[model samples]
Target chain A: MGRVVVEVMPKPEILDPQGKAVVGALPRLGFTQFTSVRQGKRFELEVDGPVTPEVLAAAEEAAVKVLSNPVIEDVVRVADIEADAAATITSEGLA
Target chain B: MGRVVVEVMPKPEILDPQGKAVVGALPRLGFTQFTSVRQGKRFELEVDGPVTPEVLAAAEEAAVKVLSNPVIEDVVRVADIEADAAATITSEGLA
Candidate 1:
């Protein structure tokens, strides 16, 4: 089991108006220290199977190329990827 | 520093053709045990300020109402939220 994840955020110079709106709405919702909010995105991918050094590299490359914006978003922070399936899959002669 | 995060997944019955494509692409991309893929979306919210019990509650509500589809996506999993600013902000008499 392998998963690729990414974090996306607005460029530092760009204004995050949606974040601002959330922040502005907070006080009324009972938050006082309202200040700044940066909106971002995350992606979760369930991979074909297993995690190896090469597969890890592959996933990272795929993410950068197709899943995320390199200029606006940071590269993925690989986390808790499993290679071994926890449950046993019993196949009658199909191993 | 407050961030509200949510995880979104497609309804089980709805076909996830994109996920299927990714799974099929894996072997070509160098994964051998290629099996399946489930694609999902994650949302990151930077809150106006500190996360209180009430604020936490509010953010969850907003996420359900506007940020996510309650039926298709699970409620946010609030993690590592912070209220204290790490860097010192020297306010010239603006307390």
Candidate 2:
């Protein structure tokens, strides 16, 4: 199986009030060195086969269409990881 | 100021108990297709200047050293962002 890592972030030039609030809350959360917080989500899916480029692209498109808000969100990064080496190496070689 | 985005993930080889639990909970959480969850953390820093390669590398190192568990955690990815064009372009050129 392969895993896709999607990184969702606020668009540049926009102010992140939630991020600011989280940053402000850090010191109280027992982290004195915590200067800021960038809120995002992490998801792992057990898809069939290895991390083919097509699979990675599809997952990311799915993430954007279903999981994220386009207006506020910036680009979503897709990292495809295959659990099994034999399939993964073959997929990578094809790519 | 620039924003540094840090992504932390569990080690690939290790079994993720939390991930399993989260995956089990997804259907109940209104996600019929939601298969799994790999938890991670995100941090944003208001660094001076643009996204120089050195700064991004340093942030990743700091994240590994201070914020993550070496035994269980795998790798930390750092992305540096500069607000102003004047600084970021120069830094990118340098990299």
Candidate achieving the largest DockQ: 2
Candidate 1 wrong stretches, greater than 4 Å: A15-39, A81-95, B17-37, B81-95
lDDT per residue for candidate 1 within B1-95, as digits (tens), equals 56544445566666777677766776686554435565655445554555556655555566666555667655424332322111101110111
lDDT for each candidate structure: 0.50, 0.56
In candidate 1, what are the lDDT values of residues A27-76, reduced to their tens digit?
A: 67655443555565544555455455565565567667655577776542
Chain B, per-candidate TM-score: 0.65, 0.68
Give the DockQ of candidate 1: 0.16
* Tens-digit per-residue lDDT, A1-95, candidate 2: 55666556777666888668756754554444445566665556666556566665566665676545788876445554322223333322332
Evaluated at residue A62, the lDDT of candidate 2 is: 58
TM-score, candidate 1, is: 0.57
For candidate 2, give the docking quality class from DockQ.
Answer: incorrect
